[model samples]
Target: MPQPSKLHTRFVRQLLPLLVLAFVLSAASTTWFTHRSQLAQAQVQRSQTLVTLGAALVKPLWDCDGTTIQAVVQAMTDQPNVRSVLVQDQCNATTWQAGTQAQGPDLHTLTIPLLYYASTGRSYSVGALTITFTGVSVRTSLTHNVGLQLVVFATMLAAVLTGAAWVFRRIIGRPLHRLREAMRAHQELTPIPAHWAEELAEITATYNTQVQELRRQARHDPLTGLGNRTLLEEHLQRAIRRAERTRALGHVLLLDLDRFKPVNDTYGHAAGDAVLKTVAQRLLSCVRDTDTVARLGGDEFVVLTPDAPVEGSIQALAQRLRNAIEQPIDWNGRALQVRASIGVAQLLRDGTTSAALLASADAAMYAHKQQDR
Candidate 1:
């Protein structure tokens, strides 16, 4: 059976890839928006700056002052990312031009016209200024900003996942581990403390109910309410391992109820069931609390003594069991008497394995029945 913590861990592992994908998509969206906004702002700022520079050249251009126009054009071209500047007269004549033409398609261009007014208040275009901006510096800065944002986003994502893992461990994983331990120890199923998620509580309740039912059916015999053959084998194996470690003796006793078929033949299965229940109670009273008594099948039972006494004391124990089985049982005001033939096998003497020891005891039981015959 898998522990609850392991299941929780597995669930988290399955969710991690989705979480990372979400983070990546969110980051991509953020980067795209930020880049576009930065580019838009840079274009606006560059346009405004060029308009101001163009306004400064209006007076110098209208006067047709060559030195002042050249000085103004040189200042505009010297500004960072200013690729080219052109000034054209009202007659569509190029008067002043500086810097090379823009190299690539990635450029921001702005055009501003200079208006000259006559004494009659009519305005006519005297010249126009055209400026082209290269986007190389802007793109470089954007690249740097994107790198920084990636680092920040990655760090935040790590911290968020780490916190989530810790919360899951404390709230879900630990509770599941406790539940698993309780189940393994065969303790009463207690309701786990409520979690923040109602669904988790419902799932836990359902799981606990199913596990309890399964354990009950697996380990117990329905008829006598005693340990079943599966439980017997488990207890037998544990007893053998403990005996080997401690160098102590253990015993397995396989018993067959003598003349049990006659009871079924005389009074039917109901009367035989009563006899079996009564015999099971009697067997319980014959041994210590540490020992285990199991029903293997019809008319057959086994007892496991984890710490058996010496040979004489062990024989006495077996004799007591036989006497208990021979005692008369009253079922529905009718008295029923039965006898048991028991076979004995000792740990390290008969065999080490549960299968070997059970076989030896089975063979001894047939031998005892033959002697009685």
Candidate 2:
């Protein structure tokens, strides 16, 4: 089984940025917020020392003595973060005593907690103070700000990701899909047109040009630039179809040179090649444009006629081929007489395959060579 593809790319392309943003923003806000909270706690701790001082002087507040209250309040002022303390009666909410720093006596009626005596039932009454302090407002502000910021950030992130996905589909996905379709079309077609997209158009055009070149190569003889085997096969198949439809005869003439090998051995392979080329040119001149004469190999060639073959037509074609090849080929102040043997085969469709026809024609040509020798 193939391994499953991972969505790791989804994580990198989409989720990573959102997560990093959230982490960075959260860390920064939480750091400042935690600092402010700690600072407020520290301030609260400092003020808490005064609560201890007021509680210690409870005996004095309970009608015990002034000296005790004064001593306690004075001691609190000396403590590290303590400012002042005022013991007040809970029932009347009146200050019993104020510290040295608690100048002007009443301190506009300070409301620190005080423990007092009850005469009738012999019970105690305690007072509570409304104290003013710092750091509370700072901590509250931070809490509100951080909560609101996080909510806004989360909403904005969702919107951004949604927009990014939409753009990716529209801009990247659609264009890439179109380009792929164009490539597939080119692959399926014979003559791949210049369907290369704007970006890859030149590349596709080059491929199309290559395809055309390949077709030309398939149809032409490499040695003489004449029709090759593929073209010959096409011709024979078409001629068969034409004969079946119209009741006309078709002929394919196969030709091979007589004593051509001796010339090649005496003069060299280069001279032999030139002689074949010359033979091709002569055959081309002898036949009409509609007729095709092509070199099958070194000393072998074929001519295809789509129409009816007369009784003497085959011999006439052979004579032309022999005369054409016998012409002089001059090289190095020496004139060479080129020569070739010819054989003819007439085609009858008769449920015959292309390969069968070519093979029979080749056998007929070899027989002709035997007769000539």
Candidate 3:
């Protein structure tokens, strides 16, 4: 029996980590790009506002218009991204300042020189205007949208992964699981459903083929391809039950090779194996389709005939098996021959049980061998 496959378990274990990593990567990438774009846009807007405010104050400063200068500065302070605004005199000293302190977290300072243009196209520096822009404003706005984006991404990822998991289980995981269970239970596995995908169908087909081959190897003789003792016993038990039910006579014929050791000792085990295979083929030919032919290890064989007619039929069957075994076999351009001594035991006459019938047949076969000696 084969052990269960961990296809689903291993797939989940591996897929989950990869999906989490992908989600993390996607989220980070989206957030990073969004933040950078928003920050750049914010920087541009702040630059434009600073230039416009500087233009508005140039005339007020040049004419020494204190009321206008204060009014313009106050309006600039009221804008949301601007933390503070300050005006400096020609000496670079702060003349007027509004809003919070110039120094603060997530704030940037920009200074522009005030120039007075004359009729001759000559410019003179009047003073400078300094404005502090709050960098946190862009990030603050991003926070809400980022949350929504993350939620959307998460939902999409979950749906995709769920579909993928279902597809994987339907095509690969479930079929492999079924095959594993059938193998573990030592049961004949039905072929995978035709509706399954081609790859899974191919896999199950290959699996079933190998399983059948393994079963054949287990119950059969490797050399002769005949049913081995295990298979023989199984058939024998069934035959015994059937005979008991029908109240019919059955026969067990045990055949042991005479002069088989000489063939092995003189010609090596290879020739002896060839002789055995040939004999197995011969034995199969001599029996009816309902009968069973099995090899019980080296140079020994058993033929089971259930619902046999009479004593004469058993004798005729035994003679036919002996004749088949005595035929010349061609191996390696050499003719090799062997003989079999067959002993028959009648079911319900010699013994009722499989063990008893086999025992009786085995004993009778040895007696036949002794008589030939």
Candidate 4:
């Protein structure tokens, strides 16, 4: 029962894990490279320090100065990270040794040959000096560096997630909420505001088109392309409400085609359809743009006039409608004449409710038809 539309669920289940994995892998790789580089630098520094020490001890071992050799070894051990140092003589005998030996895998050793200049002016190896470093300081520095890197990585990950959430709310969450509201209210779909992502914009555009077509199909007649009975009732109710608010009178006219059956029977259904279409156009031409003309059903139509003037105005509009319907329509090279019986009713005068007003108008139309017969 998980809703994919929920932003928090999507972020946690999908995006959060992906981002975390990527950050972990990147941080791990960076830490590994840093560790190797730090170890290499420590080794190079240790070797350089040992070579310098061995050179200084060469003169001491050659002169057999035990005090100087011991002093030098002690001083070398005193330097940071130096674990142990040993100096030997030409006979390969240990001359001086200082500091305790490191016993862990982190220990590193380097040995350098001690050379002396003989009286003959030729340099020869007199002894060897061995040095050992525990690498404790190096490991500490590496750990500190890794801890700093983790802090920076965490900060960057937080920033990326924050930006992503804002983008999701703007592009996905907000638009979806608006769409849901429009659906619940049964209103026309409003076009989504401009978005940074093109795919999202396209999706919004497609949704707008679909909703418009759905509304069109729901409210319009398929045959004459006019508003159907349902649309007429909705418009009538709205007009009644508006008239009540403005204290303006309104009118309703129901029209029934007088000879519509004869046209269908004598000329076939095709001619009947053409006649209906023609009558729809004529009705549209007779009224103002503010008025609503609707086809209730077969050969039956209704017109709603909001803010209508006096009774004289209503009668004049009805006469115009009858005249429009009586006009001859040319159908496939044949002149066909049709008449309509119209009933007029005034808003607030005839009735208040839509059903009551419609019944009154319908009765008036039937009375007019009987008189014509």
Candidate 5:
């Protein structure tokens, strides 16, 4: 199956980072809430412990010394992880006589009502004991909502940032780089890059295959599969361009079959077409594939040669074209002979347009036709 597009791939690439960040944030939020709940538990635990300690000294409240009270306070504060502990007596005079810890604005306080009960009825006693929790151990896991929120926000932010970079580099960057290198290699007409995506490679393969067909069509005739006028023009254009740019030698020959009209009139249009096909084959056999042989329609044709010596070479090509066409050919096993009046033209630097060059060759061919007559 073909892979998804680059756009979809990039989206998937970006989406993975977000998913990881979301997972991390969810875990972090769970952790933070768990910690918050633990803090609440700690609050309840300390308050209950203070109530027990305060209940012990109900009758001896009036006789309690600051030193004795401070001892209880010290003991509660020294309990493992407890930061500070304070206790208050119910009596209006003896309240708050525990713990040496100083109070901060961030303290948490819990109050418990004290009652004395007889078998007959319950009686209200000294009021209440207030336990204040503001100490070094708590460390303000949450302060005014902002501190806890900031910490959580920072964690999620870091995870997102790091995830974005990692996902982009791994998923998007590497593949995109490979794609770019493949495009460069294709532009240079070099071998396809190994790292090229399979889908892109398939597309390139299809495109190059179609291009090869188009190139073949451009250089070969549609009906007879021989070189056509367009092929001749292309080579002629290239030769002219090279002669101008690189000072190269170039020549073009125009050949018109002689006595071709009598064959067409005596045989038929089909026979005429066969004769043309036969002539094209002979012309093809006369020169290298590098040399272009083109049919300018009817009995007219042109041959183009580049890098050939100017003086003798152009005349020789003209003579060869004439001889190739004059040779006898078998059409459906019927033998026939044809002749061509050949004209030769040499191209100079910045010389002539294809039309003008062919016109010159045509005029020369007409001159030869008259001489042959």
Candidate 6:
């Protein structure tokens, strides 16, 4: 099966016919207008030519000078549109005429009155001049003008189509293509660059935010807002590598809350949740910023110090953690208290890997809890 077409391709395909139709309508309207204008211009030109020629022929027609009248009529009839010219005296008899009869059926005739002024300051009608104009000249001019205008319209239409394609690709197609590729590759965030366009920017931002939230939820405990076992293992592995490289002493502490199940059994899980939140905050306050605190599960917590200094001993750190857990948590006007049993394991001395270290710390933590019992 063939692959589906892209968005821009589809858009162009859908819009092409409409653009072509519009071009055809525009060309037709322009040609019609040009034809009308050419006809009107021909009429104006014929009127002007007749007025000028009649003024020159007034004296000749009055004196019956056949030579001058014939010369003037022949001159005006020589024009391309003037098919024939006729001059008639006051008796309606032809004084002089030039050219043949109308060649085409479409023809126009205009007659102008020739007046002469005598020595007595009185003017009288001498004769009339009639000229016949052919429509062939106007038709030829309309055809040439319409052809030229069609070429111009075609050029402009091509330019508009090219510009439309460019705009669609830049503004709509590129961003969506990038988004499709990233999604296919299982990307965590959108890879599209800034300053491109706002069409898909909001969608990319929303997807990236959701991805970050999913990552955070995967590696953190929802109840206590502390690192989960997955995150703790990652931190431990990194700390183990650092300790092995620097040849420094590091410590891991495993802690278990004493009598924690009784609180959950008595006051319900809500009270137990409050107690766990309080414990998490106290653990954070007790440990250094360089230390990692994680909740492995119900009432079980672990702390990893990647770089334990010589001044701070493992026993002191464990004691501090134990004391912090022993503090009272306020819940509904009641002070709930619990004790913690912590076990310490020195990196490189007890175990090397995260699993081994955690096992060692767990065994020690159980032994200490039994002693408290």
Clashes of each: 0, 5, 0, 0, 0, 0
TM per candidate comes to 0.56, 0.52, 0.74, 0.75, 0.49, 0.73
In model 5, where do residues sit more than 4 Å from their true spots? 1-231, 237-250, 257-281, 295-300, 307-316, 326-341, 348-353, 368-373
TM-score ranking, best first: 4, 3, 6, 1, 2, 5
Computed on alpha carbons, the lDDT of every model, listed in order, comes to 0.83, 0.66, 0.84, 0.83, 0.68, 0.84
lDDT at 118, model 2: 62
The reply for model 6, stretches above 4 Å from the true place, is: 1-7, 10-43, 52-78, 82-89, 92-109, 116-126, 132-146, 157-212, 309-311
Question: Could you say which candidate leads in TM-score?
Answer: 4
> Which segments of model 1 are wrong by more than 4 Å?
1-16, 90-94, 136-144, 189-191, 195-221, 224-260, 263-373
Model 6: colliding residue pairs: none
Better of 4 and 6 by TM-score: 4
Please write out the lDDT profile of model 2 over residues 1-373, one tens digit for every residue. Answer: 9776543456446775766688577757775877677666766665565466556766665664656655765565565533454455543445544334443321222245454556665646565533322333444556656676667667766776677667656655554465467556644233333433455445446656766787788888887888888888888888878877887767777788887888899999888877777788988987777677877777888888777534366577678778888889877778888677666666674335556766777787789778877
How far off is residue 9 in model 5, in Å? 13
lDDT by residue for model 3 over 1-373, one digit each (tens)?
Answer: 9787676667778778887788677766776777778788888888898889999988888877777888888888998778899997553344977888867667888898889898899997878899999874546655746788678768876897788889988777777788779879876567568878788677778778888898899999999999998899899888888888897778899999988898899899999988998898888887788889999987889999987844467788888888888889898988888899888898878887778998999999999988998
Q: Distance (Å) between predicted and true CA of 131, model 2?
A: 19
Error of 5 at 325 (Å): 3.4
Q: On lDDT, who's better, 3 or 5? A: 3
Looking at model 6, residue 153 earns an lDDT score of 67
In the range 250-332, model 6's lDDT, one tens digit per residue, is 88999999978888888888999999999999999888888899999999999899977445678888888888888888888
Which of the two candidates, 5 or 6, achieves a greater TM-score against the reference? 6
Winner on TM-score between 2 and 5 is: 2
Q: Looking at candidate 3, what is the lDDT of residue 21? A: 80
Question: What are the per-model C-alpha RMSD values against the true structure?
Answer: 9.1, 12.1, 5.3, 4.6, 10.1, 5.0
